[model samples]
Target: MPLSGDLTGDGRISPMRSTAVGIRSTRNPRLEVPLGPFRPPGLSLTRGRAGFGSLVLIGALALSMSPAIPATTVRDQEVAGVATTGGEDPGIVGDSGGYATAVAQAHPHPNPIGRTDPGGVAARAVVPAVVPVVFGPRTDETTLRRVRTIRGQIRPKSVVASGAGLVIADNMMYRHSVTIYDTSGALIRTVKDRVTLAALGWPDFPTPVSGAPVEAAMSPDGATAYVTNYSMYGKGFARPGWDLATPKDRVDDSFVYRIDLASGTITGAARVGAVPKFIAASPDGRWIIVANWASWDLSVVDVATFREVRRIPVGPEPRGIAFLPDSRAAYVTTQYHDARRGYPAELYRLDVGDWTLEPIRTDLGHFPRHIVLDADGRYLYASMTGDVTVIKLDTTTGKIVASVRTGAAPRTIALSDDGLSLYVVNYDDDTLVKVGTADMRVLQRLATGHHPVGVTFEPSTRTVWVACYSGTLMLFHEEG
Candidate 1:
């Protein structure tokens, strides 16, 4: 629970404060890892600092951006018995003390994308290969002070910002909830619902139910936040054996819950493919696109109506996705760690105009995990896990330009809004890495908490927020 920030967007608002920005649960569903080609046992999948210091914000959420439509209603979800326990204060540091973990190439997480096993399978590769190398920004590391931490969930996946005062933390493992925080990093809402599973078409729910929420994206206007529900609560219709959830795998169709940030309501819920992992909106806010892991497709929804426009088929285990600045093309990365199918993971390119999906010739080898495009949309980056590297790809030529070596297992990859730097979350070593997008060099590699799963960039404050699977959100800001 490393809290950072001063409750303002560029130091304009009052100091941090908290009010009951109440949200009601509408009950919805929800949905990690890194690993290899030849294979390992427990492999699994899935940025920045002032480089905000002694900074802490305490106040009600307030934003300076243009508001989107207010949520007429919100879908609140709740897990039966999940609670938040605070972490011991580790004492603050100023751009100091974290250690960089080298690539051991040893003991990679077996569970790709955070699940037990896709159970081995031979995967098909339909494109040519293109490997690239990432070079400079060999910039140094700057450590930020640990000012505060949140104790609301067990394994928080990712924290999303809306250019407003509120940020949402998607909790994966226990509690299946999303913790909402003000820009100052104070917890405001934990979204969960107690709906009867029967209503969601699941006859089971012999008891009241809740959902496991994963990744989220906000509309351009900052009024609505879209969250992906990974799985359902109360029972095991997911598998044949009768057991609670041990491996963290879900079998049912997931959902996307829309929330009106300002009103604090879980506005609506829409069904998508199974195990929905990542979500993003078109630049114009016309559609909300979701990547469904188990379903092997993308769910495109009408933003204003929340209706499914199409369920576009992708390969398997699709993880991270990003749209070009013009919203013309989207790139998705897949974890080829499926043992049964044995499909080599790859990066798929979807042409927005024609709605066509084709694999991008990538040098990421057999397993590519995450992706993000530059603000200019000329180059795109992907975390090539099986190869233990991050690559910068040329969108025009569909070839690699450069590749940078990373720690044991690299999960998620993000870029600064200016596309000047890349931040990667290396899960196995609990490390956060920063690289200069310009030179393709490793700038900073700092240690994080146990199993860090999610990393998000807040351009408004030039801040980086890291969420740990063990329940903590650490904040950092770029220094001059």
Candidate 2:
């Protein structure tokens, strides 16, 4: 079915019309897709066995008439179950192999403070025209090299740099919900996600509910940390959130826990949209923005009140978010590919002041998962799972200046404090790649544990931390 109208901000499916492309959904609860008006072309829906046979015939006919769809059409299916294999030696790339670099022309009205007019003239008219560029790596010197690996029952989905000179591994419903490590890779403590919602302001009923931690963000002072729960596993949560679920599913809402870093205690909790994934705190420490994967929107939480202030609809499967240095704007990645547009995905720029969004068009391939900003906030580095490459964009001009192929299924990315290097993990390849930001060159690559899904750069120790889904953590240190 083709998605027809706008989402209603609440976790409900929008109007959809059946007709066009065929989409096979996964059985994984965490990998649900949003329901839209995507209609399979030339296929008719029926309730009986005869209708099923007719549907198959129509699908086969449509496939024969059209070009084969790329394997990336189904998110993560390409590498989800693939074996972790690697034989490449760590080395630096010298050039992009003559691949083209896409550059987006600057819009006439480049004012950053502009709002989305009611007519959407600012949103539509100011859309930059992006020139297609060949996706590959540019060159730089190697600095970060593999140091060691820490293995155990830690099934981490993401690793974050807590401001207090610590690294946090978010273990989603694993043995431990979160694991804390010092910059030197020493285990500090493990915190469970079980909390009393009534104590945190939800007074309807009191019960000890456990949360499946997915991602986390630290406050400016590092005194506090906010972690997103993939799902709640106790009372008050009836319908679980799915990774590939539509709004119509009306999945149970999740919560973000505010933790006191010193005591490692969940001090507060705020309800948010379903399946909240990537999260970030504004530079000025005024607000916390969460990218709700299933809800296709953002929950803005006020730091002072520790409550969700507003929920704004972005697009389907909003995954990554990066705020500007001044806390005036944020960049979000809606990684869901739209079959109707026949394009990969979209990136949006949110006006923090007014809660308005402007879609930034790009040729970056499907599933742009993780994004990070440079120290100066002038350039943005994004990891594209579909393209298996990382592209750098000039924030002021909105141009794809450079790109480099890392490996298959590059997930989380981290930028060096000095803004000279970038670290990315290749989930399918089971490798960590260090790239020089100056030219988007591959500085070095190293074999990691199975399914290295998350990476973070620790400045205090100048070391790189990686979280592997195979219950291991890899650490890389800078020799320079």
Candidate 3:
């Protein structure tokens, strides 16, 4: 299986390198590379042999020219926007002309506030894996009410809240491989990422393998959680993945483990490309997309078959991903700036129906990492490592509408249930910042543990959870 590179822009393709079979060491900190001259050697635009489609085509997008947005000068100052009622239009402009109607028909589901159910298994159904949060009236102010800290022998790279009342922290090969907690910030169980691949249908090696869990995404129904491994350790694997890996690196492929939330066991594993970082289940629950860091491609796995259906080549170091509410499109962020080609941090949008990839140029600054869209898919928020801030983008027009100065190295972000409050974790600053979407102002900022990399919002308690790489899980409650 040679690597394909027709879409890497350099037009250089290379054959796959053989793995030097052995278990490799696991490290925690995801590299935050400095901006410099770096050129990607290749990109794999090939679909998987499972055959969703083999025809690889890159379409040039003719995006309408929009005025270049001036650099945001406002930092924490509140720049208010026009107020509107619950059903009134936000007046967001562009191609999503039906935004108002969509917002009107959208019924905001009241979060199960005090539910203590860990989570009940529901019959598997083919529905959207993720339901977009509906925007509600933002009349109430948000403030940090209290903070709770959960300490253990762990180095959490990320924490994900399964809207059904559970939160999982991927401990990145630490003593506790992964930690599970209830919505009330209590520990449920700590699971080790040790699994026998043969039992999961991989007959190549019958022995047990250990994976360094990086990030996780839950299925729409909340019955299952998909966790991506930074690298697999044990038999039949070699060459550990590096954070700043390039095409020249001969890294081994990784796996995405399927955790049955009810049973809390690793039920299945899908082999994906090297250094899989971010994983997301599509809203329609038909696919799971994994961003392969070293391989510079995406593994689009079919949920029904539990196998990769497509391997779409993206640019180097793809980190963050966000999908549209209708599951019609997915927006992926590539962190690497192709200085050789004069390209800044690039954002690619994949059309789900046709699997065509196109770059959506925006003036949202450099090193775009995590991204999240509003309920109506009108506004997109992305954290920029280069800018040390988060910019709000008008998705329809691909222009930065508003921005706020988040602290240095803002890693992951979480949007509130009502889509009115955005939570961001500054890894370098060891703090979490809450921003009001209406005015793009910092509502509050609270100190966190060391290297706070992951952040998530729990709708049940309306609390915020932050995962620190230095063994801490901090929970914060929002008060008016």
Candidate 4:
């Protein structure tokens, strides 16, 4: 059959041919033939009839059958062919089965990504990969907390009984002395120089010497006072009881005299280390420990025999000695030195039971002048050249937990009876500071004279005593 619709050789279709193709299928033709536009060159009729009469006869027959064709029938048939073929909707043919299967197979629960699928079958969630964080296990806090909670159990509320006395060493005009004040801040008696000189076997000197009483110690019962006399010889054969030097008149030996507290009489005298800076008795009052500033050794004396026992070798410029509560250990503080030369000063813990000394591994900065321990023994407080260091000591582990800073040039520290407060003597500022043990907070500051050096608290009197280098002792109490 001829192609339907506009099949003419020219661009335009005649109205007659358009109508013929539109109605060709509805009509009847005398012969089976083609209709619409004529074929192009090199075409022939299906039935070979070579004349125009035959061509006209075929045209008439196609016109008679034109009613059988419908308008735009060829376009409809082309669309139907494409639909039945695979060309149209290729994506649907490729993915439809797999997509349907996936939708049917999804879980009906929450997914690991914390999300839900479109049909609410699964939730999307994320599971983290495993990772471990390791740390050094420490029990310092538990130990400190336990110590603080039990501090008051063994500490005494106050000193019930107290004894007072004094020891004096003579100077040129005025006798330098220290009076042991009772809890009431009252001087019990005056200890003067004549008694001290007589006790030291220095009988008669026409000219008075320019020396003073440097330090003193009292017996446990307060019955006797031992005073150290600092004296120097200037000219001629040195007087009795004073060492005569070769050229510079430096006294080779110093005297420690014992005095009767009640009678004010000299009882005993012995030569001790030169420039004795401090004197302390053993816990049982059987031995006396003295730190000689000019010497690099400590002198130990048998209290009963009044004789030297042993001189323990220590660091350079050792100044302070503190015996542990059990009396088994004594801690000494030394002046700072160049560690490169093996002279670095440190805090030495001396095993009194064996006389063995070991340096405490701690960072005390430089110039640890004095050292003290807290009531519970959890901490060591050291007064260095410029600050006070509160070292949290682990006695079992032998490590330091923390080192806290304090005022400038702290010389000494005295812990209160309650163990909650610490009083520091700042030599540079001449001030006494009360610090809280728990939080390391400064509670109070009391001004004093120039160069406050030593600090001690008398529990019976509830007063804090400060030894001023400016020639006076200051007493501080709550100003109510």
Candidate number with greatest TM-score: 3
For residues 108-224, write the lDDT of model 4, one tens digit per residue. 111123222211111212221111111111111111100000010011101111122121222111233433323322233344444434334555433433333555554543345
TM, every model: 0.66, 0.70, 0.73, 0.56
Q: Give the count of colliding residue pairs in each prediction.
A: 78, 32, 4, 25
Compared with the true structure, the alpha-carbon lDDT of candidate 3 equals: 0.64
Worst 10 residues of 2 by lDDT: 40-49
Pitting candidate 2 against candidate 3, the one with the higher TM-score is 3
lDDT of 3 by residue, 1-480 (tens): 222222222211112322121111122233543222212111000000111122211111111222221111101222222233233322222221222222223212223332233321223432222222212124127566434566755667888877655778887755437777665444556678999999988999699889888898876655568899888878989776767675678788989988876557787889999989888777666778899988878899877667888898776678778877667888887775352332223566789967876556423456677888776678878887655799888877666788899898888887875567788899889889999888899988899988888888765345688888777788776654
Off by over 4 Å in 1: 1-147, 193-208, 234-250, 337-345
**Candidate 2 vs candidate 3: which has greater lDDT?**
3
Model 2, CA-based lDDT: 0.62
Per-residue alpha-carbon lDDT of model 2 for 353-460, expressed as tens digits?
Answer: 798765554344456778888655688888877657898888776668888999988888987644567888998798999888887888788888787888876543
Cα-based lDDT for every prediction: 0.53, 0.62, 0.64, 0.42
lDDT accuracy of residue 137 in candidate 1: 20
Q: What's the residue-level lDDT of 315 in candidate 4?
A: 46
- Whichever of 1 and 2 has more TM-score, that candidate is 2
Runs in model 2 deviating more than 4 A are 1-142, 337-345
Model 3, stretches more than 4 Å misplaced?
Answer: 1-140, 339-345
